[model samples]
Target: MPAESDLCSLLALGPRPGRDAREGACNHGQVTADEVFFREWQARAAGETRSLARARALAEVLGVLPAGVPVLVVVGSKGKGTAATYASACLAAAGLRVGTVTSPGLRGNRDRIRVNGQAVSEAEFASLAERLERAIGSLPPRTGGYLAPTGLFTLSGVVQARERGADALVLEAGMGGLGDEVSLFRPEVVAITPIFSEHVGVLGDTPAAIATEKAGVVDALTRHVVSAPQTPAVAEALERTVEARTRKKGLVEYVEIADVPQEHLPPGLVQRAAQVGCSAALRLLEGEGLALPDAERLEAVLSTVVLPGRLSWHRVPGADTEVLADCAINGTGVAMALVTARERWANIDHVVLCLPDHKDLDGAIAALGALPVTFVRLPYERLRFTRPLPSSWEVIEAAELTPDRLAGLGRHVVALGTVYFIGQILDLVDADTTRLFTAP
Candidate 1:
């Protein structure tokens, strides 16, 4: 049978036989299944010389297509995804076709890319993946003899968005500013949210270094630069970077979160940051000849914007207790989550805490030092680092705590920290089983 036909047949048989039968034949570029074919193709691409350069060349080809559109790039230490979502929603609300790409999806792979708040269909993603695999084949080898497929994938998504004639492309940077794959496109408006310490390995050690890295998204001002309020160290670094690069090129505008009246500042700074993002979007749209209705009407819309896993809240069943889960993997986010939790639930006496491997344990402990309460550590098997608590704090296994036992402690139990752990807790709560306690 032909190679494509054989591949199709193998895939039709499903994963088990395909995995066992196609071992050696698949690796040597002999196509046995779609999965094996893609893996082989990726392996060959990895053997190329200059993957990023080739990826850039491929992007150049994609860029020349007749579907050029304005792009908005959102960069920050945290809340970039939420801000991007708000911007996309506002644009969509204004009758514009908006395509948004955000990282670290909460659910499925398709959640990373959305056009007007709707995920791309499975058929569309598969078709794009197939076309992208072909595009990678045409690129030459890199200097180190490895082809980079990540850049091609990113470019493919961008191309697909443009092909659909999207009015605006909203992209959230994956890492620090300069060398990130999202930086490949020259955005019409570049907005930077607040900065905090994160990705210490890829970004620099201090908050200032991270700020500089995030500010790398701002190039010569051929596009507008929207600066969100930042901490002293971060704001100064961003101001310097913006002035130096875009001084003679394009306009640099700063949106002061503090300037917005206190009544309009939402309940928290994260919400304020999101509000700033909406304002920036309005400004960008107005510049593009799209008029917004009014500040009050826009604020009404902004008040209802919800981004999951960032200060997201849910009510506990059969109780008045509410669970607040935020992605507090770093010092900044932890501080923010703590403050927000305290402000929202001042009288709560206990908290169910689950610390992920990525979080700063010492810092989080210190940040919560001000509160007088009990800490019940949720039982989570997926954690990379699981050990007994330090002498300073008390830890309780999630399994041992019953609804009756929990109700005896206090009227409310705040579940804070990693969203993954929160998800596990929610799953256990939904099942109405004491699995969290008995599993270990």
Candidate 2:
């Protein structure tokens, strides 16, 4: 990887993608190279309140929002990421090319943007970044400036959609939709999953406040808003937002989770994703007059949709035990992971948890407290805000989680936390899925 100084210079001078990493250059905005630029951007975006002005300003600078491209915007505290991913799969399965952009990537920045189901390759990412260089660099640096990287990413997704002649675009909100980058797209439909009390400091202290921010995705331009089951407070908040923002008495469709067909669904969060995703997808497809998939094929697609870090498990080659992981960001999300872990594993010896310094640590610890297991704190090996390990839990370094040590535990080892941390653990373990498979 090129040094930080070199990357800073490149970021300042405008990204020069398509260069080979072998030549000590950021291989045309590849994952590793992109991180350098994203890091610099994060320094400018972190802790900043979501701003509509910022989103609009960046949109004006990019000026590449493709016309007539169907947009599906998902906003919520949980399940939105999975909903976006699953919806994209459903659309593609129905034969429409889909361009997708999501956040808090499970592995790397590349995972945040995709064509169909594949991550954007180094060349493609670089070429797009290079194409929009001037626009991205020209944005003024405000105190809590626009989340330049995210806007750039959304614009790039739109470009990819146009380039691939994608019939649709799937976007996952970076935060609450009141001023989230995704909201600027003027979505045709907004799908919100369950809402929880997150970003309380930024969004608000009450569930209604949080829900309003989420519901704000349904701007006057939105024709429809679809969502899974929601709390009473959240429901009311969303209803109010729709009533206030509807362009021509737009409809708000609240699809209950139980309504989704799940006879052949898998035993994870993907089922919830399918329920909401398929429901929202069907609404969008039917509204657009696009052909929907057959029942049998739809079932097959939903059944096989594997979203990592959502009650996901994978084994390292030759390792005796399987590693279960999830990128759940809040206390409720953490609790869901634990419940799923209990159902999948007979004897879990350790539930390794990694919570960022900014998250609800108390809520997470409370949720995990009942489990008959040990809590080990592991470092999040990426550059982000992280609180110190509490005195209660045992501390373990990421580098120390050797495959042999994990195998020695003689019980299930489930890892949970940020995407980068999970990716770092897998990297350290050098997990090679092809070598062998160990049933979890």
Candidate 3:
């Protein structure tokens, strides 16, 4: 068997549609080179002298690139990817060529890179990865040392996206700003979606600390800083950070998202956040003399925008049950998800949950605990951490899992928590047709 490094090389060798004699049979016409490369790269980085520092330094180096095109850097505790997607979609709707780069894809590796609201093809991703590897290999080691291949790869994607003629690029920052790869590129506009408590160990133990970490993106901005309405503690932290930095460098302009008002918000908060992001984006474009449709048209276009996996609903195949896979793993997200679920599925009887190891387990339990529903815990095979899950909930094994089994328990099965669990469960439910709808 080839070594992991060899596997990375083979996968990076461009997306071949058919089975290769050298590599095994192709799954879905292409292998995921980025996944293979990142996994190996992450493993190597983990073994290095200073993994976190190395990751951050590498991300910083990768973040800096030749500038010309407009860039939108989205940073926050949650809703970063969704906000980025909405921005990309809005730009595309306005007839502008836009590219978006996000992490932890839902379906396939190609889902991480999208142009004009469509995932780049496997062949394109493979070619880009190969080119990126070569570029990183050629760069000289800095006196202060250089970043790793993962950060370099991320930077390469941004550069590639720009090279593809993207009028604007929507870049989502990694977990935090200080060391996140996205912070390297000095964005023309920096947008913070919303602050929440997650990644406590790395960012800090409190919401204020987390906010300060996220506020690092604001420092890298050359033009404008757009922030979502944050909690008092978070807002104070952000204000302190921004004020201290702006005093040193008077080029940054901070724009509070609240200044835009809830009335200007596009019907739903999710949609409103998206519109606000696009509004900030449009304002950036307008400064560059880019023509955009009238306000009414832009608002209309935003009204049609849709984001999947956040309160995403679909009908179960065999059962007359409806399933909701909301990507709300933290406290605030869980609260929002519960509210949305209650409004949409007033008659829901059962709620299925599969939370990530990183989620606020206590908060999640409390949120669900209040619901007048029986809870069935889904399998946690794919999750990294599993200890924090509630003890009283029923655990369903993968083999024994079926829509009929779920239907036998209650009328509606609303699956909330991690997106991965929802994705996995949905796939299984789709494949089994025996558990068809009997009587509504």
Candidate 4:
């Protein structure tokens, strides 16, 4: 690592005051209460990595559940949010009241927790947060002190579901499944999305090792598991972990994306992953005697499935430029985005990235292959990281990404990095943004 002055000189930008620089939110003006709540966790995680001990303590404190309420633990490296959303939405469309807990909000913290595809009202969120605070206050402090914002946010979502009389609760593990709070969840169904090379430092260094951590989400009581397609190494590791239970109970299933035709869904890697997760989830639900919606209803609901910040496309106003924004922070994500962009543009001329300081920056840049890149900074605080700026790419402030500036990059531009930055750009590009992306 470089000294503060050296780092700034190298990046052509100064790092903000660590904690006081800004809260975990976009420049969309005022800070929200939910953002404030997440900041509390940020403050507690200061200069420390999360631990299994801390996660367990936090889960014990917030583990209250309504009798017979089923939880579906969505576990994986990437696409967990989209997968959970699809499963929840599909199940809900089938007449079951569904509540989902997602991470790294698209709009704000309000998008973190939802029931029946809608964020809970601000008042309801406030009330649930207040109750959670009180409950958390009653627990004994950790020896070193820690906070699990995902756990708190997740539990609050479940509490909201209980209050609203929900039939199912979908929980996503923010990180590795082993130590993450969702591991404590008594899940009736555990759904594993695609495994990607991420969090290698914290989870493990290899694909098989990471798969083991992911397989930890399934326990003895877990009646069923629905997994998206995986590479051979990932499959071996996952099978090794689940072998004992499988031999005794015969309860492991896989859903291959190759089997699912993508002609009806939105065209993208994210949508394909969603289809895989939804297909597996549907199979599991059917086996469990849950009556899923008819083919027509499922088609209608899936036709409206919106995957924001994942190779989402848009045509910029007042120009013929085609813009695609993605939350591809890691090398693999960036590589996939580049491939898809190449597929669309034939020869992608300009690549805009806003990766945080902690990602595989060299790998991400290398994944750009021959395409030129322009580096920009976004709000990187508690959630994800950004890499130190490379001396080669042009560095610009987050506010510098105006419409006219982007329009000049090329006839086709692929913008990627963090969801925070992509969402911010979407906000700047179009004002009538109801969802994460503007209507094309």
* Backbone atom clashes (below 3 Å) for every candidate: 16, 2, 3, 6
* Candidate 4 global CA lDDT score: 0.65
TM-score of each: 0.69, 0.79, 0.75, 0.79
Give RMSD to native, each candidate: 10.3, 6.8, 8.0, 6.2
lDDT of 3 by residue, 194-219 (tens): 77766665577798998887777655
The full ranking of all candidates by TM-score, starting with the best, is: 2, 4, 3, 1
**lDDT of candidate 3 at residue 78, scale 0 to 100:** 73
How are the candidates ranked when ordered by lDDT, highest leading? Answer: 4, 2, 3, 1
Question: Tens-digit lDDT track for model 4 on 1-440?
Answer: 00110111112111222111333333322234444345434454435544456545544566554325777888887778777877776776577787778875564456777877777666777687677666667767655545556656666777778788888788877666766667766777788878867666557778788888878877776777777768889987887887664453445567755323465455555665576557655665775688867766666666666666677777767877888888887777788887788787778878888776666677787788667788876543333434555566788876667777788888889888765667655554452222321111
Residues 1-440, model 1: lDDT tens digits = 01221121222222222122223222312122134213432345322332345556666655623227777788886667767877776676566777777654343234456676666665666666666566656666444433222233346557667767778778877555665556677666777877777556447778888878777766663357776766888777777776676674335566764423345333444665666566667766876888664556545544555555556665545776665656665555666777777787866566556665556776766666645434445333323456444565566654454544444546555556654444334432332211101100
Which residue runs does candidate 2 get wrong by more than 4 Å? Answer: 1-61, 138-144, 247-250, 257-260, 264-266, 328-345, 356-393, 402-405, 426-440
lDDT of each: 0.56, 0.63, 0.57, 0.65
User: Which is the better candidate, 1 or 2, if ranked by lDDT?
Assistant: 2
Cα lDDT for residue 243, candidate 3: 64
Candidate 2, residues 243-358, lDDT tens digits: the string is 78875443777775543466744455556655676677777888899888776666666565666656767675586677777765566777777777778877677777666566
